[model samples]
Target: MAATGTYTETFVELIRRASAELPAEVAEALRTGREAEQRGGLASIALNTILENVDLAREASAPICQDTGTPVVWVHHPTGVSTRAVKADFEAAVREATARTYLRPNAVNTLTGANTGDGSGRGIPFMHFEEWDEPRIEVRMILKGGGSENVGAQYKLPDGKLGAGRDLDGVRRAVLDAVVQAQGKGCAPGVLGVCIGGDRVSAFEASKRQLLRPLADTNPMPELAALEERILREGNELGIGPMGFGGSTTLLGVKIGVLDRLPACYFVTISYMCWAARKAGVSIGEGGELTWLS
Candidate 1:
């Protein structure tokens, strides 16, 4: 299907929704975490404030967080769709979103230390496009903030320092280490998206893709599912608490994905997502009809 002029407007709305609202599953996780904390403690207070922000952002049609991190999008289009045209629409939508304040001007020139102002620098909205058999175009996006991005970590296994071997246990150790190091810095009560066994770049990409999964969904792989649960349970016990205030609500959820790696490389990448967890999706029909996928 050919791209239409309406595609850009549809994408702008998608960006607005993603930036202004937290996903239902993520918000539910935060609610559950808040209930688990001491009612009058600092952790509770932090969670309460976060929830308030969520509500206010939605009500005001404003961004959930001031730092509307990078826009990372995944697009699944029909076999004959033109990726270049789709990308052009995405770029236009990003500029429109920035102008409307749904997204902040975040794209920066790495070497020059200058902001792009329109959120349209090179690779500004990092996107991945895949051809699918489906008739409609499906798009999923995540607005990942700078704080959480800063706390993301990658580890090479069989390391003596962490006593981490190239195994599931090593993966567990690396994820927990990332959490401890982040403390409250990644805007705790965070969620983790972990990828095991990919090369350095693919590892990080796969890990961030895991963040697009719903918080309540189970990993199809039995072992990975078990690890996710174990990590979530143990992570909350570390007393990192909400926003690093010291409590039992450190992480809201954990999602894990895996990729094949070379024998010499066993890389584990963890992408930390702050509680805002701004994610949204849409399906565009051939006639430009829109369906929100949340």
Candidate 2:
């Protein structure tokens, strides 16, 4: 696969690593969130499970859970690359892998809402794409589960400052309001990602990217970084804690991705409640090759 300049190995690794590693972060957060219920002791349990799961998954290279989630695939095609047919071809590769790996199928016909007979076990892995201003192809897959997805919300904001109506603080308030409304429903002890600019589509795109930012990386802009930190702190203070069982750690992190919007409306898109944030990513090469993730 490497000799062919394809990303096959990376793709395979994505599946294998996700299976094993996902449980650690997921279970730990859940465990800790649980402990937090009573002085947040249950948090230890989640943390412990996280530690154990990673150890076990590494020793036994398998998926963390059977529901590997919608395969959020991001592909960046370089300037010189011809992607006219790349998207369709990659979709085919996904189907082939699903069958071989026996991944749960997630695609359904909207009109009929019926399942397609494939290795996709009814509903599983989803694919999203974009062309980058680069020459190399970068593909990432996030096996996002469904439980946390339900808590997402969007708002155009009433007299939003972005629309030259009020101030930026309104957007922050909306975020807080959304999280509070979500409560423990989202399987707390999670993360909050926000998209603060662009139209509906681009704003959502920015929000999606926030989920991909490495957990340890800091925002280059101090203002944005501080805002993220504040959200994480304040969000945790909400007491939504693990599995909604009740705890102090309502969120593991808060990531905000923003782009300058037009002088119309400040669109805010929030994605939340990653029960365990069970996601994995990988890279794919040219000529329709795939690589796995770690």
Candidate 1 stretches greater than 4 Å from native: 1-4
Worst 10 residues of 1 by lDDT: 1-10
Candidate 2 residue lDDT tens string, 168-213? 4666677777788788776566677788877887776567668877
Q: What C-alpha RMSD separates each model from the true structure?
A: 1.7, 4.9
Error at 231, model 1, angstroms: 0.4
lDDT of 1 by residue, 244-284 (tens): 99999899889999999998999989999998888999999
User: Over the full model, what C-alpha lDDT does candidate 2 score relative to the true structure?
Assistant: 0.63
What does candidate 2 score in Cα RMSD to the true structure?
4.9
lDDT of residue 263 for candidate 2: 85
**CA deviation > 4 Å runs, candidate 2:** 1-10, 23-60, 100-102, 119-135, 159-166, 283-294
Compare the candidates by lDDT and give the number of the best one: 1
Q: Model 2, residue 158: displacement in angstroms? A: 3.1
Local distance difference test values of all predictions, in order: 0.91, 0.63
